[model samples]
Target: MGNNEYMQNAVTGWMVPHGEHSDIVMSTRIRLARNLRGFRFPIAFSDEQAEEIGKLVSDALLNGGKTGYAYTRMSDLKALGRQTLVEKHLISPQLADAVHYGAVLLSEDETVSIMVNEEDHLRIQCIYPGLQLENAYRKADETDNLLESRLPYAFDEEFGYLTSCPSNTGTGMRASVMVHLPALTMTKQINRIIPAVSRLGMVVRGSYGEGSEAPGNVYQVSNQLTLGKSEKEILAELANIVSRIIVHERKSRELLLGRSRLSLENRVFRALGTLSYARLLPSAEAARCLSDVRLGIDLGLIEDVDMNILNELMVFMQSGFLQNFEGGELTAEELDSSRAKLIRERLRQRAADGEPHPDEP
Candidate 1:
């Protein structure tokens, strides 16, 4: 499918709920940063040099018997297009800002994407639905091997892989899982949990990763250091930590259901009612409501609505995706209205198709 066509589609493999803990865990991602030998890092590279590196990396991956990969230059995409990609997590905010010679090579299913001329010469990434870190790592490692076979990498006898950032030097691998922790957040346990996790070489950031706010009670938990650990060790450590966090979240959820069942159910149904019938919905408010509704589904407070729709709405409600659906730039006010319309239409359709309304007995 073409880039525009792919962007418009609601379903991607990673967005679907599957694997272990799909209820709370959104997805797992593995990213490997590698720089080409004898080339300057992206920070100091000229436009010509960036172009050269982009071509070299793209050629190696697309021509090295790897089928189903599409190459798109960052400069060729409009702001909306790039923002759409960022919202979908197919590319990073940094890559979206790369309006020069930067490019991305995306697999057909979008499970794998290689960003060329980002912070490094290549940022190889693979993502999977719901707590599948091992699967993501395996795919990323396979792509790394495919590229390393065809392109020379900057490596060191001591550091393993050379990257622009010192923190990413050794394994050059960042393993992360996106999780919904509404129960913990509501119970005020997230504050304690984040610091405790950080003490264990893990960092928790908002859904879109670093430097972003966590809307919808969604957060990305990732390793903080890659300098001294092997890739296996890093992945194992992160998996263990995330599993524990999941257990904590589940416990908090049970506590909430036990002690404050009426209050929790009231909050969830109110959020669902707002989403189902509101005439105007801001992006942030929409995200918050969606989180509550998702919590309701997981706790069995509500049934019939598919979790996949909530996942899709999380991306679709973003400003860029909403504007893309409308085919124009929108003022903040317009976006709010459009977002509400989209939500109401979607939820109303589900209701029309035999799903009971939130207000129904």
Candidate 2:
């Protein structure tokens, strides 16, 4: 798809947007990794073979399915554009660097995306806005089934599906939820729980997924093993764990309000104050401040600020997005200044409309 379409469509179609329990449950996602029957794994392929594989999947997606997906050649996108896609969670970091041989197929609404020739020959994923595990899984499964019918997928009667990673050999399904655990973080609970969750075969990774660090108290929790587990079992187990975490987060919020209401208010308002007046804010700092502000809004400590502003900030505040918004490349210093200006303007606009003022802090 064109950059215009990607820029417009991705933001609107983000899964698990801000909503009920969304303060804790940011989004739910299910990813299925599959390989074509005869193609060598991407690493094993010659450049010629990779090109052929790309065309093969691209053709199948564009012509074989009823789904109206827009296809974008990875080679056509600039590095910043590709990074923006990663920030949107519509593509993986590996896929961003796929360079000449990779491509992505995204549904018009951006709910479903298939990464061609990533870690696996194809990574088909579906996303839901909130804590909808079953819904995300169902959509992902449906998309996978349709693709399997149209293309030959490598399978083993003994192992299930083959993938580049041995751990993904069986169901090749990874179901995960992106949650905002600021309360858990603030209460010093997440540090204690992370290792415990790891022992349960659950993995907690940063917001950008595996190998990334959790920023702004946002965490992505998912099952660690896809092998030997049925899709239903996997989804069920993940849902149970996520639901419990949701409870813990909610309780943490309650505890904060009951025991440290003044402290909480000070922290949140300070964050808003920085965002309102800072002339230059780093992306990491912006993320931290935004998290506090978003938490304040969700907890009703601050009202009249729309959730959409926070959600949109998560995207446009990123470095690549800042450059995209300004329609050119930006030096690091310029990006910091621009990010601060954007946040200041948005918050001020809301305040001018008679919303809660951060000035009190």
Candidate 3:
């Protein structure tokens, strides 16, 4: 599909529900930072150097026996298109903001993407639905190997992979998982979970990763130290920690259900009611309501509405996606109205399909 068509579609392969703990764990991602042996990092590189690096990486991936890979230059894309990519987690904001030399090589399913000249020479990334760190890492490793054979990566014998930042100098791997923790957040236990994870050499960032807000109760949990650790160690440690957090979140959900079923149900259905009928809904408010509705679905409080719809809504309600859908930049008020209309039509259509509600026999 072309870029426009790709953006218009609501679901990417990574957003589909699959793998372990799909309900709570949204996705697993593995990213490796590597720079070319003969080139400066992106920050210090001249425009000509940046262009050459982008070409080298793009050519390697496109011709590296990857049948479905397509390359696109960042400068060629409109602002809306670039922001839509950021919203979908397909590309980083840094790459999207590149003036002349940033580009991307993305597979057809979007499971694999390479960011050329962003924070490093290449940020090779692989993402999959739910908790599948090993699987994601395997794919990323394969891609890294493919490119390493064709390009000279900057490396030191004692330091492992050389990167722009000292923190990423060793293994140059960052493994992360995006998780839905509405129960923990609702119970006010997230404050405690963050510091605990930090103590274990992990971090809990917002959904978009570093310096982003966690709308819809979605958070990205990733390893902090890539130096002095092997890829296996980092992946295993992160997986174990995330598993523990999942247990805590599930228990918190049970606590909420046991202590205040009526109240929880009221909050969920009320959110759903507003989404189904509201004439205007701000983006942030839509996210909060959707989180409640998704929590309800996971807890068996709501059944007719599928989890996939909620996942799509999470992206569709974003400002960039809404504007792209409307075919123009929108005022805040216009965005709110369009977002509400989109949500209403989607939720109401699901309900109108004659699916049995939870109360039905």
Better of 2 and 3 by lDDT: 3
Model 1 TM-score is 0.96
Candidate 1 on 217-245: residue-level lDDT in tens? 99999999999899999999999999999
List the candidates' TM-scores in order: 0.96, 0.93, 0.95
The local lDDT score (0 to 100) that residue 158 gets in candidate 3 is: 96
Lowest-scoring 10 consecutive residues by lDDT in candidate 3?
A: 352-361
lDDT of 2: 0.84
Which candidate achieves the best lDDT against the true structure? 1
Candidate 1 CA-lDDT value: 0.90
Off by over 4 Å in 2: 1-10, 15-20, 349-361
Q: Residues 205-302, candidate 3, lDDT per residue (tens digit)? A: 99999999999999999999998999999999999999999999999999999999999999999998888778889888899999999999999998
lDDT tens readout by residue for model 2, 122-229 = 999887777888888888988887778878899999999999999999999999999888999998999988998888889899999888988788899999999999
Looking at model 3, the pairs that clash are none
Report the number of backbone clashes for model 1: 0
Q: At residue 316, what lDDT does model 3 achieve?
A: 82
